[model samples]
Target: EAGVAQSPRYKIIEKRQSVAFWCNPISGHATLYWYQQILGQGPKLLIQFQNNGVVDDSQLPKDRFSAERLKGVDSTLKIQPAKLEDSAVYLCASSTRQTEQYFGPGTRLTVT
Candidate 1:
């Protein structure tokens, strides 16, 4: 099976700038998620979507981060006015039911 795909493998931006990342989950998956993995830390769930409906976004910084899964297949995550702390690896994952998730090669963001 094809794995998840993400674009812009890496990015560098100044603090307060905005950036967007894209993801295409494995076909047929119904659940998608966005996570932030900082250096030396495990990935933290930022948002979740179940067939285009948001399931969870409690950990997402609403002030600067927004995400959407359109038509239940593709997803986009955007961060505006990014802070230095926002520099991290942004991961996209998908799963069926409650089973294991398949992760994409994450987008590494560097904020200077």
Candidate 2:
């Protein structure tokens, strides 16, 4: 089976700028997730979507970060007024209920 796909594998921008990342999940997967992984830290769940509806987003920094899963397949994560601390890899994953998740390569952001 194919894996998740993310575009613009790397990005560099000044703090306070805006950046967006895109993701496409594996076919027929119902649950999708977005995660932020800072260097030396484990990945943190930023959001989870089930069939285009948000299942969880308690960890997301709403003031500057936003995400959406459209039609339960493709997803996008955005950061406005990006911060230096926000420099991290943005990962996307998908899974069936009660199954292990498969993650994408991730988008690495470097805040200058």
Candidate 3:
């Protein structure tokens, strides 16, 4: 099977600017996730979707970040007025129930 696909492998932006990252998961995967990994920490789950419906978003920074899965196939993560603290690698992953997640290459965001 083909792996997950993400666009713009790298991004650099000024603080308070806006950015968006796109992802296309493996065909037929029912669960999609977005995660953020800072320099020294593990990837933290930012949001999760089960077939176009959000399952968890408590960890997401609602004030500035948002995400959605469309038709349960493609997903996008967006940050508006991004902060310096938001500089991180944004990863997209997908899986079936109770299965291992396949991650994309990730979009590396740098907020100056």
Candidate 4:
């Protein structure tokens, strides 16, 4: 099966600027999750979607971030007015309620 896909691998942005990331989950998977992983820590769930419908988004910082999964296959995460503390790895994972989740290489964000 094809693995998850993410873009840019790395990103550098000034504080208070804007940036975005993209993701494509595995085929036949219905559950997709986005996670933010800071240095020296575990990945934190940012948002979750099941077939175009959000199942969880409580941890996402809506004040400066937004996300969408229109077709339920691909998704995008955006940050406007980026903060210095917003620098982290944005990871996308997918599962079919069975085995371990497969994660992408991730987009490493650096805020200057």
* 74-102: candidate 4 lDDT, tens digit per residue: 99999999999999999999888836688
Compare candidates 1 and 4 on lDDT and give the better one.
1
Report the candidate with higher TM-score, 1 versus 3. Answer: 1
Which residue pairs in candidate 4 have backbone atoms (N, alpha carbon, C) closer than 3 angstroms, thus clashing? none
Query: Candidate 2 — which pairs collide?
Result: none
Model 4 spans > 4 angstroms off = none
Q: What is the TM-score of each candidate against the true structure?
A: 0.98, 0.97, 0.97, 0.95
- What lDDT does candidate 1 reach at residue 90? 98
State the weakest 10-residue window (summed lDDT) of model 1.
93-102
Better of 1 and 3 by lDDT: 1
Tens digits of per-residue lDDT for model 1 on 1-112? 9999999999999999999999999999999999999999999999999999999999999999999887889999999999999999999999997678999999999999
State the TM-score for model 3: 0.97
Deviation of model 4 at 63, angstroms: 0.7
- Candidate structures ordered by lDDT, highest first: 1, 3, 2, 4
Over 1-112, each residue of candidate 3 has an lDDT whose tens digit, in order, gives 8999999899999998999999999999999999999999999999999999999999999999999887888999999999999999999999997478999999999999
Compared with the true structure, model 2 gives a TM-score of 0.97
Q: What would the per-residue lDDT of candidate 2 be over residues 32-79, giving only the tens digit for each residue?
A: 999999999999999999999999999999999999887778999999
Residue 101's lDDT in candidate 3: 95
Q: How many backbone clashes does candidate 1 have?
A: 0
